[model samples]
Target chain A: MQDVKAHALLINEVGLHARPSVKLTQLAKRFAATIEIAIAADGPWTDAKSPVKIMRVKAAKGETLYMRANGTDAEEALRALADLVNRKFDEE
Target chain B: MGEQKNVGIVIVSHSAKVAEGAADMVRQMVGDSVPLAAVGGNADGGLGTDVGAIMGAIDKAWSESGVAILVDLGGAETNSEMAVEMMPEERRERIVICNAPLVEGAVMAATEASGGSPLDAVRATAEELMAN
Candidate 1:
């Protein structure tokens, strides 16, 4: 399939804060893909699959985090990942 | 004790990082479509009597639905139980404490519920997240 690439917002009250960051990391690991999040100026690219990695950047709500996943099922992985962040990690 | 009717997921552990890690995994597997709330603690958050943090999670989730609290016990199991015991009996009934706990269980249950109604998902998925 094609690679999954999209931008999502962190609308949760806490923002990309810690919880959402952690969720993004795990999403990257799920489908055997490379996932990365950029808060603003190009990355601050953490594992995107590791909460620790994502937490490095302090993101607040309403910020745009761009995510991209590329792998075998990169397209599917990206859809789910993008949907998650776009949906404010579903906490919204 | 009224039985679960719309539930939220809560995770408790001495290590917030561990709890956070579990949360991440669960969220990925569960999808962000669900309505879930989580609160964690360090050992100092009251590892022994840390039910407050989990309770807080329940309260947060309560805004959306009932809650199922998951505790990651190292030596804190006893204290965790005590914390839950401290809750008002009425509130206790609304919350289910699963000591068979895995950080994943909470996430799975919460995630499944986030997809829609949590009562059935919590009961079914709480048992075997990997299976479902």
Candidate 2:
């Protein structure tokens, strides 16, 4: 299947800090999709399932974060991840 | 959730508060999904590590998936080593004392464990922070 892709603004106060990163990875792991995240739409994506890599993304507040996933659950994974970022990780 | 075992984690520090604090961070981030325990201070409640306490913490955090331990200082590492050594030979291989920053390592390890990752992956995730 073609990779599913999505992007959302990092509206949370701290962006991809420890808590949010943990939340993201935990959510990503629930799907069978092989997901990757990038600070920009062009390149340099990292594994969405690794909390450490997600934290290292360091995408600050107001930044746009891109995500893409491959696998049977790709579309669902992208939707959930986009929804998560849109909700500001439920931090606000 | 309890039906699926995740790698357990043990935090060791010279100060009880430090160990407890790290464990608290792990819980706050990962919730109780991963087995966790903290051990610190001497029997007298002084700032020192006790082998018995470490051993107990290991037992408390034990899982067939394995246990990854994080220590703060040299003494804490030494005591953790002794604690691991004292365990049954068969069970010893399942436990590892990670050489990573205590609080960060515990948090990372617990996060990985919460995902039902194996002990090596959990330990690797925790240790990877040291390179940053």
Candidate 3:
């Protein structure tokens, strides 16, 4: 089977603030899939379910984050996560 | 309260720093007896389904009375729901999700109600969310 793929960018003015990160972290934890994400250009690798790691990304405008979810409910998680990154969680 | 139960707390953040930071803050206010578990989105360069971490925290809370999980934004939001979904019908009632602020609301409720059993603390945390 092919790996499920998803991606998101930090577009919020502040970019990945505490509140948004918290909300997103909880969402990702609901599934039974392996999720990993990283800044397309630069930064360290990290799990999607962690705010401390995600916040450390220091994503500015135009920074792209590549995400992949594999296992059960991967597609659902991918879609919502993609939307979250794109929607900027209404922070935009 | 039927019994003084110890509730488990899970703090999820977009990164480890945030979860750690929240954990640190909450640790200070609450007494040492209460069990607290914290997980972040910074594991292995990706973020998704931290089943181990989430389960560990939940288990800690459930050891005695039951467990209540709290999460921040990002993956934590979805993860909380997932944890609840995995529970058996009987156990499902014991797990509580605090959609409110992980750092503030959940911490406050957890600390204040820590005296009661895990179920009491979990209920208190949920009630706080509903009220707020």
What DockQ would candidate 2 receive versus the native complex?
A: 0.81
Q: DockQ for each candidate?
A: 0.04, 0.81, 0.02
Extract clashing residue pairs from model 1: A25-A49, B1-B93, B34-B114, B35-B114
Whose lDDT is greatest here?
2
lDDT of each: 0.61, 0.91, 0.63
Choose 1 or 3, whichever is better by lDDT: 3
Best by DockQ: 2
Could you tell me how far off, in angstroms, the CA of residue A51 lies in candidate 3 after the best superposition? 26
Candidate 1 structure, TM-score to reference: 0.46
Displacement of residue B86 (Cα, Å) in model 3 is 2.2
Off by over 4 Å in 2: B1-4
Taking all chains together, each candidate's TM-score versus the true structure is 0.46, 0.95, 0.49
lDDT of 3 at B57: 63
Q: How many backbone clashes does candidate 3 have?
A: 63
Question: Which is the better candidate, 2 or 3, if ranked by DockQ?
Answer: 2
lDDT of 2 at A63: 93
The 10 consecutive residues of candidate 3 chain A with the worst lDDT sum are A50-59
**TM-score, ranked from best to worst:** 2, 3, 1
